[model samples]
Structures are given as structure tokens and as C-alpha cells.
Target: MTAKVLNIIKILQPVVIMVVVQISLAGVNILSKLASIDGMSSSILVAYRLLFAAASTVPLAFYMDRTIKPRPMLTWTVIGQAFLCGLLGGSLLLNMYMQSLVLTSVTFVAAMSNLLPVITFILAICFRLEKVLLTKAPGSMKIVGTILGIGGAMLMTFYKGIEIKLWSTNIQLYAHESTSTNKQDRVLGTLIALGSCLSFATWLIVQAKLSKIYPNPYSTTAMMNVMGSLQAILFALFADHDWQHWKLGWDIRLVTVSVSGMIGSGLMVALMAWCNRTKGPLFVSIFSPVCLVVVTLVGTLILGDKLYLGSVLGSIVIVLGLYAVVWAKSKEKESIQCIEEKEQGIV
Candidate 1:
């Protein structure tokens, strides 16, 4: 293949991988809901997931990254990454999100997730990982996209308009009763979910830094998972002293831990780190809003969820906003590359 073809493939590969990551995340959301049905604490579930994730990734880290000698400060940097990503982002964020799912509709949980990219973009700018070139069209598009995405998410959260019934006879609308329909509970859940988004955004910033310092995806993931597992287990032990909550069997809980550990944390974290290294946190994070759409489809088709008008409308807006942001970033990158080439030619 020509260099141009290879370059195009390289640029597009992360986008495709990020989409797969979102789909896997959507599956994790549905499976987590299913697993939680048995009355498992979110903290406990997270603990097990982290443990499994650590076990699964450690071998790969040792095998793949063994040849590279680590800098002394790299350990400290990795620890920081662990605390930011594993404990706060992975364990705490997920636990809070799961709790929110318990209180609100799955659609609400998914919709709220669209706020991630907006949060990450803001954090990225604060950290100097992203630029706000207001003079440029790309910058304007990004700023506008951020506003639209956040606005759409807020609209979805507050508004539950008329239901939109689709024409598929097989897609029956099965309205599952929310655990707490009280307005207060929903509000609380929304707040918690928003908190999760903030933590996750913080993780993206930290991961971007780590990618530069460590530059080892598998080892970084394993270290983070190990630290997260320990932290989660300690929290779970303190919060839920009951031995029964810690019990594991050949059931959905097992499936949840296994799949979540292997695919969700192990695979997803590695992919995210690689993407962050190659594309930057904003590029990786912008794909998060897509999960809302994926989850809506999954909920409607597989889980027999009723499609609501507000959700559909808000999701459409969110998607449009996401596209705008991605387009802006793409154009900005291309423009920068072109300038570099021109400079090289002049030299």
C-alpha cells in the first residue's frame, strides 16, 4: 500500500476501534444491570471486576513490555495513573454509575453518559492537552459541538416526552419499573452519574499524561487494574461487611466479572491507552456520546425498552454535536500536518 493509504488507515483505525470499545461498554452496561438484579453491591461487583482484570492483564504486561527498562519515576507516574484512572475513574466512577442505573432508567444512564466528551474536552483544555483556537473554524466547531452535546444531554435528563413506537412487531415495549421513581431519587442518581462523568474525564487527562510518560499500554493497564482491585476490595470490605455479598457462583455475577474483566477493563483499557497515545484524549473521548445511541438500540431491540420521543430527539442532537466535534478535530489535525509538510519542503 502507498504511504497515503497507510496514513489514512492509521488515522481511521482508532476511530473504528473506539466504536468497538463503545459497543463493548454498552454491553457492559446491560450486563451490569442484569448482574445487579441479584442484589449485589456495585462496589463488590467493581472489586471482582478489577481483580479479574488485573489477573488477566498482568501476564500480557510482563510478556510484552519485559524488554523495555522502566525509568525510576515511571513507577510513580504509573501509580498516579492508577489512582486517577483505576481507583477514581474505573472503580469509583463505575460504582456510582451502576448505582445511578439502579435509580433511573437505563436510557437515562446512557443519555447521561454523553456528557463525558464535553467534560473531557474541558479538562483537556485546562491541562493544555487541547487548544481553543477561537480564531479558527475548527475551534468554533468544537466549542459549538461541546455546547450542543451538553445541551442535548441536559434536555434528555429533564424531559421525558411522548413515547415513539417503532414499526417492528418483534420489538415489543417492555416497560421495566425503575427501582425509585421518586423525583428525588432520580435527581440524586443524575447527580451521581454526572460525578462519574467528571471522574472519567479526569482519567482521560491523566491517561494522556501517562501515555507520554509510560508509553506502555499493557503494563500500564495491569498496574492500574491491580491498584484499582486493591482499592475496590478495601472499600467493598468496609462498606459491605456481609460475606454473602462477596460470594461468587457460576451465574450472571461470574459472567459479569469475567466478561467485564477480560473485555471491559483488560481489552478496553489497553485500547483506550493506545488510542490516547496516538490520537489524544479528546479524540478518544469524543466517541463516548456514540454509546448513548448504541445503548438505546440495545435497550429497545434486545431488552424490549420503549423508545421515547425526548430520548430519540436528544440523541439525534447529541450525535450531530459529536460529528461536529470530530470533524473539527480532523480538520485541525490535517491543517497542522499540511503546515508541517510545507515547512519541511521550504527547509
Candidate 2:
């Protein structure tokens, strides 16, 4: 009986961990939105966040080096890959995302981000890393999901239906501030957010290659953080010449950077790596919609964000599409695993 309980706990552990990760990510979005509203520069925030991430993760990487045997020697190729990963995933992606958050509502950005996996799938196909078995259910589902996701995003972007009045907490954190009310700003923000998603998808592809080369998650992440910090610092310096924007105080800005760095980058990275190893990427990816739901609820209730009919319908569609792709991917993985087992006479 004890062994059975232990087995059950082991099986459920990844699910619980993923739920926590998604909630933590939702917090990051909320804090980032608040900080942006409070006049924090997104570029500067990215720089500081990556700096803190590097500081917190580098020590762990060194510790991992000491404990793990047969450490791969750091090479120029690894350094180059890390640089690209940092550029695409950390500095570029975060800057665009935060900038879009500044220009748009938190819920909008969160909902749009649900397109990441679909975008990644398309990119993988372009890179020839994934095959197109159109006749197969998995392949057909991928294409269908891609269409649904893109269509949902378009609906959210071009169509603003009547506002849905959800119950509000009447507690406005950034009561005085407002997101961009201008139509141009919203359109620009949506485009930038899509760009960030593309950057993130490309990063995943590059990181996959980097993983094959380096294989040390801790050290690789640390290097990426370091590279991202330097790049973001340079970019922020160029973008914002005002020294006042660089200053951090004991306020939302400080809290945002610290929490985003420590939790979003440091702890989440470690937890996700563990989860990925244990339960695969599909398991981790499927939990993304939870973050969107959390953000929508929290934003509407606490931040006084208004929900539009189009946004609601689009988010639902995107989530359905996300599940379709994840299910298809799982089926593909199972098929491959089955083939491997059969070849090995384990089936």
C-alpha cells in the first residue's frame, strides 16, 4: 500500500509542479504589467531581469559542474549557440513581449502567447526537424490546429465585439494608469507580440540544437542568461538615454525585476527542466493555457481590465487549438516510442 501511494505521488508530481509553474508565470505577467504601468521602461526591465537571472543561475551552474561527471568542455560553438539563444529567447523575446504589454492589455498578450507551440511546430517543419505526414491523424491535426490558432489570433486582432462586464474587485492596482487606447498602438502591439512569439519559437529550435551539443541544462541556461543580460543592457542603453529610467527603487519596478528574474528565469527554468525530463515537453506545453486563464481572471478582477466578446471567443479557440496540437504531438511521440520498442524487441 505504501509503495502504491509512492507510485501515485510520483505520477502526479509533474502535474502539480507544472500547475505551480503556470501560476508563477501568471504572477510574472501581472507584476510586469503593473510595473510597466508605473512608468518602468520595458527594455530596462529586461536588462535588470536578465542580470538578476544571471546572478542567481551562475552559482547553480558551477555547482552542477562540480557534481555532474564528464562535463563537456565549453567551446566556441557552444558560446555562439548560447549567444543566439540569449538573443532570440531572452533579450529580444522579453523586450518585445514587455513592450507589447505596455502597449496592450495583459489578457490580450497572454492569450496571444498561446500560439507559441503552433508557431514552433511550423518552424520545426521549415527547419526539416519535423516531418509532414499529412495522411496521418497527428499531421492532419497539426495543420488544423495551426489554422485555428492563426484564425483566433486574427479575430482577436481585427474584431472587437461588445464588452463583457465581468465582476470586478474594484481594487485597481494601477488605477491612474491605462493601457494604450489608440488603435494604432494596439495594432502595433499585437504585431510586436507576434514577433516575440516567432522569436521564442526560433529560440526553441536553436535551443534544441544547443542541447544536443552541450546537454548541461544548468550551465547552458546560465550562459544564456549572461549573454542576454549583456545584450539587453546594450540595447536598453541605446534605446533610453535618460538615466532616470535606469534607476530602480523599492517599488513595483524592483519587485518586478527581482520576481521575474528569480522565479521566471531561475526557479521556473530548473523546475521546467526537471518536468521536461520526467514527463516530456508536451506535458509542460499543455499547461500554458492555465497561465492565460489566470491572467485573464486576475486582470479583469484586480487590474480592472475589460473583457471583450472577441477576446473571449478568440482565447477559447486558441486554447482548443493548443490542445489539438499537443494531443497530436503526444500521439506522434507515442508512435515513435512504439517503433523503437518494437525494433528493440521490448514490445
Q: Who wins the lDDT comparison?
A: 2
Give the per-residue Cα lDDT of candidate 1 at 47. Answer: 91
Q: Rate the local accuracy (lDDT) of all candidates.
A: 0.80, 0.86
Across residues 1-347, which tens digit of lDDT does each residue of candidate 2 receive? 69999999988988899999989989999999988888888999999999998999999889876877788878999999999988997999999999999888889999999998888888878879788689999999999998899999988887888989887667878665354667798889999999998997787667767777787877888888999999999999999999988999999999999999988977776677666555655566678888999999998888978888988999988888988898899899999999999999998
> Which pairs, if any, clash in model 1?
none
Collision count for each candidate, in order: 0, 0
The list of candidate 1 runs beyond 4 A from truth reads: 1-9, 67-74, 125-135, 167-175, 178-180, 334-347
lDDT tens string, model 1, 80-119? 7767778665778778888898777667788777777777
Report RMSD for candidate 1.
Answer: 3.0
RMSD of each: 3.0, 2.0
